[model samples]
Structures are given as structure tokens and as C-alpha cells.
Target: MSFTLERAQAAEPKILANGMKSFDHFRKLAGIPKLDEFFVDAGELEQLLPGLPLSGDSALDKLSMLADNDYRTYAVGLTRWNTSGGLERKREVEYPPASNKIGYFNGLALVEIWVIDPPVVKASCGHTVVNPLHLALSYSDDKRIFDERVSLELGNMLEELGYEFENRWS
Candidate 1:
């Protein structure tokens, strides 16, 4: 489907609202030291996540596989950190888990399409980290990339996977 700027303007609030955790939270969980493929310290990362991927080229290989094939990057949700929102408090006490799979960097695919061994939950959801590397801040208001590429895809994929989307905007 063709995504338009108006649609993006309308959807921005909802996209930002979907279950955002901190970069530190998912970073520890995913065992990914950094977002871009080039910056990962393999040796240290391996020490951290013993069993999972992230050895040598395996992590990038897996990233390409997940992104190109099954919307794998979507699994590790990348979101804009709402500075005003602050840290996310633990809310599972009230609602059922937002995503069916609540994973902590195990490398197992969290998508419902794949029934992982023992039925593992969601692997990772990308979050907004206010950092120099976050290019979203650079986007001109009229040309916000959130409407076009990764964010839209990730948001839609989450909805499809039964993620209970929350509109913190309202």
C-alpha cells in the first residue's frame, strides 16, 4: 500500500505510543551493543550472550535474513523515545503482555509465523534513544521518514502480530 505524508502525520502519535522500552533495556536483552551493524564489539558481545548469535558475521547475516525475509527487523521494534514520556514503568500487572513473545535477546524469531522450539516469545522491539546517531531528529518536518520506511512497516507488523497498540496521544 502507498503511504502518504498525511497518513504519516495522522499515525505518528500511535507509532510513538506502541510499547516503547528503553535502549538500555532492549540493548541488554538483545545483546546488541549498538544499532548500526558496524559498531558491535563482537568479542565483548559474545561474552555477554553466550548461546545466541552475534559471533563473527552471524549477527549481520541474521539481520539481513530477518529484515529481507520475514520482517525480522520489525521484530526488534525501533521507536522514537518520547523525552517527555520518561522511563516506562512495569505495566504487565494490568494488561496481558503487549506482544505474544516477550523475549530477552535469545535470537529466536518472535513472529507468530514461526513456531520456535518450545514456542519462544518476541525476541526484540526497537526503541527510541535520544542520541546523535538517531537520524530521525534530522528529518525535516515535511519529510519525516517515519511515514515512509521502517517505522510504518514495523508498526503495521506489530499490529498484525496481535500487539495491543496504545495511543498515548489521547
Candidate 2:
């Protein structure tokens, strides 16, 4: 189905609900005994709820808006960095640069959805680099186990939404 603002708005509630459920599944699969300790200050199940509405004309905008709305500190700057594997890396990036010989679309937002306990799945907004908008999900850990578990959880959530999603790992 075509992605429209109205459609997005309609899907928001279910999407958020599933997103949180996906997180819980991730925690269980990851063998995280305590959700409170695993998910920063928020207690188990509390952190996932009442996700803020992300505002923007584009899907990336909405995602970023939702991320920002959920975490105020991260939104002050257009980009933020988090430590992963002992190195600090920018959490967001522009999709296409002018130097590329192949035509690639821009205005896409590549966001890393951060959770205290890392999930296995990597989420992306578009099918390819040429796609205009994207929201890619990555975790702090680089373990294959995490990636696999997260991918499964994410796949299940997307499936519940009836959204076409690709599992890059398989």
C-alpha cells in the first residue's frame, strides 16, 4: 500500500503498540532478566508505552519527530553520537551524497533506534539507497545473536501491521 500521511496517522497507534511489544520480545529473547535495569530508568513495560507522535511531512520526519518526542535530549541537534563497540559514531546520516555517480535519492533519515538492552533486528525505511526516506534501526552491540533476535521481533511486528518488510539477514 502507498504510504500517505493519513494512512500513517491511522497506523500510528498500532505501530507504536507493536513496536513496544517487539521490544519486550527482544528483551525476553536476549535473556534480559530485569527489564527495569535493562531499559535505563524506566521500569519493565513502562518505557515502551505512550510513544509520542512524530510530526513531519515525510516518513523520516515523522520517525525523527517520534524519536525526538520520545527522547527530548537527542532532538536538540540534527545529529547525535552514541558509543558502540568502544567507538563514537554518528547515529544519523544523509542517504545520498552528490559524489555518487549512480543516481540516489536524498531527504532520507537513517536513524538508530537505541534501547538499553540491544535488540537483534536492523530496521530501515526504504528498500534501497535511492529511496527518498528511510529509518534504519541498529543496536549498540554488534553480536549476531542480538541481530537475529531483533530481526525476528521486528519482522513479526511489521507482519502484524501488514507492511511489506525485507529481512536482510535471510
Candidate 3:
């Protein structure tokens, strides 16, 4: 999971505007869903319909780091979901600018996962410098220990993260 915060310019509005454009540019390049960023507030986590571990700090950190700097923070957690039984696939990228590249792609990965009595999953797709399909499939496989609901919900949640998705089931 990742969180971002942005300190918008209170001074010249142009700075804010430039900042916004850069933010959007990176957001688009990173393949983050604009909607997810909008609806999910860090403060609203405690009040969400379902009890979730997600918080506003994660979201804030994501937004804050979009500027010409590295300011994003992330956390990792694990949960279980039903699977067809198989080896989960994984990949590694070896290159320079790992942080920024990772940051760019990581910022776009908007997933709302839960460590509830029963876990939940949702996945979404989008365009970016990186292949969202790869990211989505990795997530699906990672959480395969859960049920279809988790997968389905994961898809929706991912879409909320800023990816354009088509429901093959629907």
C-alpha cells in the first residue's frame, strides 16, 4: 500500500497550476485512477462501510510526492484468498532510476485491500509507462488465496485507483 500528500502552493496560483499539471502528468503516466484518489480520504478510512486497514496517510503521501521530489511513503501487509492452487508469478526490473520509476508506477497502483476476518480483493486497469495488465495480474495471483469476491472487488477498487477498466464478467 502507498500514501501521498501534496502541499499545494498558497502563493502564486501559477505555481499551484503548474504543480497540478505536473501532478496530473505523472498521475497519468503512472496509470493511477483519478477517481480512487478523490473518493478515498485518509480521514474517511475509519468510517468506511467495511472495516479496512487503509488510511488517509497513504493517500496523502501519494499526492504529496507528485511534485519534483520524492515524498511518497508505503506499507506492506499480507492476507489470504482462495486460489486454484499454483505457483504465484513474480517479476523483477533491474535498472537505474528505480525509485522514480518505481515511484511513478507505484503511485498509480490504487488497491483497497483488507485484513479482515475474511479478505477482500479488487483490481482495475489503466494506461501508463508501465503495463497495468502485469500489475493487475500480479495482484490477482498474489491474493488468489481469497474468493472471487476479493478478485472482483479488487478490480473495482483498482479502477477507482485511476485505471480504465472493462468488466469481462459483465
Candidate 4:
């Protein structure tokens, strides 16, 4: 389905309300030290949630399995760009040549779960410290396949815990 920011924003509150406690449970299981580190390994998720139903390399396949079991899924596609040259340059070359792929995922995958009372704090020095309650999964260079696996496993766990699951690409 085509993703709309308005729809996503409207859905956020419900997702957060339903998934907050469960999200915290998974975060503790993953041993995440910070909030922004939303992604976890499939192995870790499996270890934490032994009864999850989906597995393997393909995100689509896993998502299909979840749908069969009556879970809602959404996919969002994301593109990363080099913005070191500032806003004007960013607009000028939105999609740079392939040579500039370093430090960027031309098509990165992200799975986000909403949460309430995100653990974010602003320090006296004015720096924001984020300890998010939401969940997001992404593929890293070293473990390219794990992102899909983790996202699927997370969905299974959330369902088991009595929350609706939505998968987004962005």
C-alpha cells in the first residue's frame, strides 16, 4: 500500500497505546542500551520469544505468514542521501550516483512499532537523550539478512502479547 504521513501519524497513538508494555518487554530482552537502537537480531528475538511462527531470509514471506494468522502489515520503502553539502545541494542531487553509496543504504528497510511515554530526556546542557519505547528493525551491512528475520519475529511476539502489528518500510 502507498504510505501517507497523515495516516501513519493518525495511527501512531493507537499503536503506541497498545504496544508500549510489550515493546518494553522486547527491548529488555534485546538488552538495548539506548532508545534509538531499535533493531535487534533474529537470533536474539527467537531466544527471547521461543514461540514465534515465522523465520528465514525474505521479509515478504515472513509478512505473508503473519497475514495468514490475521496480523496487519504495512511496508515502507526508504532512500538515504548525502546531505553534507546542505539543503540546496541536497535538493539538487537527491539521488546521487552509485559511487556515493558509502555510509548510506540506497534502499534501507525499517520496521517501526509505536510506543507511549518514550524514554527521552533533555539534559541541562540542552542535548536530548532518547530512550525510546517503540521498536524499529533495519538491516546492517554485517548482518544484511537479520533485519527481515527480526522484524517478523517481533511481529509474532507482539501478536502473542495481544497487540496489532503494522509493518512499515520507512
lDDT of each candidate versus the true structure: 0.25, 0.26, 0.27, 0.29
Model 3: per-residue lDDT, tens digit, 19-104? 22232223223332111121222232223322332222232222222122232111112232122121122222222224554344
Cα deviation of 169 in candidate 3 (Å)? 9.4
Worst ten-residue run, lDDT, model 3? 123-132
**TM-score, cand. 2 vs. native:** 0.22
lDDT of 1 by residue, 87-109 (tens): 22222111122344544223332
Model 4: lowest-lDDT 10 consecutive positions = 84-93
Model 1 scores a C-alpha lDDT of: 0.25
lDDT of 2 at 11: 42
Instruction: Estimate the lDDT of model 3.
Output: 0.27
| TM-score leaderboard ranking | 1, 2, 4, 3
Clashing pairs in 4: 35-132, 74-167, 76-169
Error of 4 at 55 (Å): 19
The clash number for model 3 is 30
Q: Residues 1-170, candidate 4: write the lDDT tens digits.
A: 22232343334344355454344333324332211212233343334333222211222333334221122111111221111111111111121223344534222222222222223334243433222122222222223233454455545645654543333111
True lDDT of residue 168, candidate 4: 18
Which stretches of candidate 3 lie above 4 Å from their native place? 1-140, 164-170
